[model samples]
Target: MELQLQIKMNPKLYLRDPEQSPLGRNIIQHSILMIQKIGFEDFTFKKLAVEVGTTEASIYRYFENKHKLLTYVIAWFWTWLEYQLLYHTNNVKSPKEKIQVVIRLLAFQLPDQFTFSHIDRNRLYEIAITEGSKSYLTKHVTQDNKDHFFKPYKDLCARIAEIFREYNPSYKYPRSLSSTLLEMAHYQFFFKKNLPGLTDFANAKDDAGVVQFLQHLVFSALKKGS
Candidate 1:
């Protein structure tokens, strides 16, 4: 008689279950839709439940409260973004090109239907602006939670920093420089378009213009050797 051994795979390595419940997913999506329509400040749990065709109590079963729901939505966005970045940058060689790809991707050139609408885009920008200090959604956010959102961004910045350091060994502010570049890249589109006259540079009319402007600004700021 011959005996065969059966191997049990780790669920996380194979088909791991979602940390959130179905109701949780519904609440997150509904809240995001409502925020897109009415903005986060105006959105409420009651409204989301009604929109999702579920009771408010059902939503609470998954999320402890509105803050948790918002956190979930924000986490979902980062997770979605990480997947997109990884997919787009998988074959791109050279850290410089990777940095360029990330800049272009973040500068609103990526094909995201959810982010294309002006209303949706504005609402998201509002959330980012307020969530750091004003919004209750971030009340429970600890350093670890913040790091979760920053992981993808940090990874991209690290890659760019690596290239910068390789070219200019004296570069002392890799993290700061890369972060500033990211902010400048994003602000060129989000802030410039929404809050015109706030800066010297006029709002860009086209996505390509924003990308080109950011590319030139970042490359021009680099040290002569770098």
Candidate 2:
């Protein structure tokens, strides 16, 4: 894959800081690659250290445990996603156009965004669908701590909400329909596509069809007299 080629040819391409010691970043990068190779359930610090030319102790300095590393990976994914959204949405005047661009960017980026091995992807999908529900209920019903995994998405939704309010000030809603639309767009990707067996929407490829479907759904829902 192009992503694997890029990683293999230039490991530092993924690094944000050239000055900082490459040890930690390199270790994390290798760990991610390991997760892609082997299912996360089978991934271990020992295995990662062996594969990445490091010790488990060295890896511990960067991450306390595998779960922490996983959280960091998820957080990094959101940060990258937010950067892409901002980069693409700049100078876009209409909220509708911005929304369309967001959907298109998401669809185009999915193959590159989650470039894991097929087995690992399926395993991660299971976790996202099952554990995600438990985590959602736990956060809402007990702790009230928001998951960092959603930081980028929350920021994007807030921006969309602001645009919606700007366009329709008198509309009565807690948040703009734009925000809801963004959520549904992501839902269609992660839930509908990844967890198709659990969802009713079938044969939905990440293509222009999905983009138009989302755009029409949002536009119709937010129509002047809906």
Candidate 3:
């Protein structure tokens, strides 16, 4: 039997949970592709409807608007990522080594060992690195934050922060550093790809350099009292 993973999502982000029905699944599956191809600015229900072979109303039945839909998918990614971080680190004994695993998970795609069933993990990752911030960087962010739209992201950071504490309980900025590591992973990769001039890996265009840089920064910070 092929076991699949299901990440529970925030209900406020959607009118109906898309995981419950086929049309809802289609909406999510195609939205990632369309968003990756055309981006959030150009993506719309009408276009997504055409892509998914459904009406705009059908898509709206699951999501309140494109922004909420985007949040839904991005939150899904963070939740799944948290699972990946924990699952991969569960047996590891060393806190530093566990965090190293977390960095690698954030930096690279895994060989597809299990079927995800509905969503394309690559498309979703691309959309996340590119459009993930748009989900929260809005005028309504304060209200959205109050409603816990960003919980999965915060949860992921919190998990990392806990690990950081295990490595160095005296570290006062664990949460800040945890969130910084998460954002740095995406920004460095983005720089490596498009804005190469902004990154040191312009010549090599290597994910390994990003991993090394992150390792240096993380371990350097956790090096007890500098």
Best by TM-score: 3
Model 2 per-residue lDDT at 149 = 39
RMSD of each: 8.8, 7.3, 1.6
Q: Which predicted model would earn the best lDDT?
A: 3
Write the residue-wise lDDT of candidate 3 on 74-110 in tens digits.
9999988887787778799999888898789888644
Clashing pairs in model 1? Answer: none
Which scores better on TM-score, 1 or 3? 3
TM-score of 3: 0.95
lDDT of 1 by residue, 70-189 (tens): 544444443444455666677876656765776666664565423322124335544543342232234444653443634544566676666556546676777777777766765655
List TM-score per model, in order: 0.67, 0.64, 0.95
Model 1 C-alpha lDDT versus the unseen true structure:
0.55
Alpha-carbon lDDT, every model: 0.55, 0.54, 0.88
Off by over 4 Å in 3: 109-114
Greater TM-score among 2 and 3 belongs to 3
Give, for candidate 3, the lowest lDDT window spanning 10 residues: 108-117
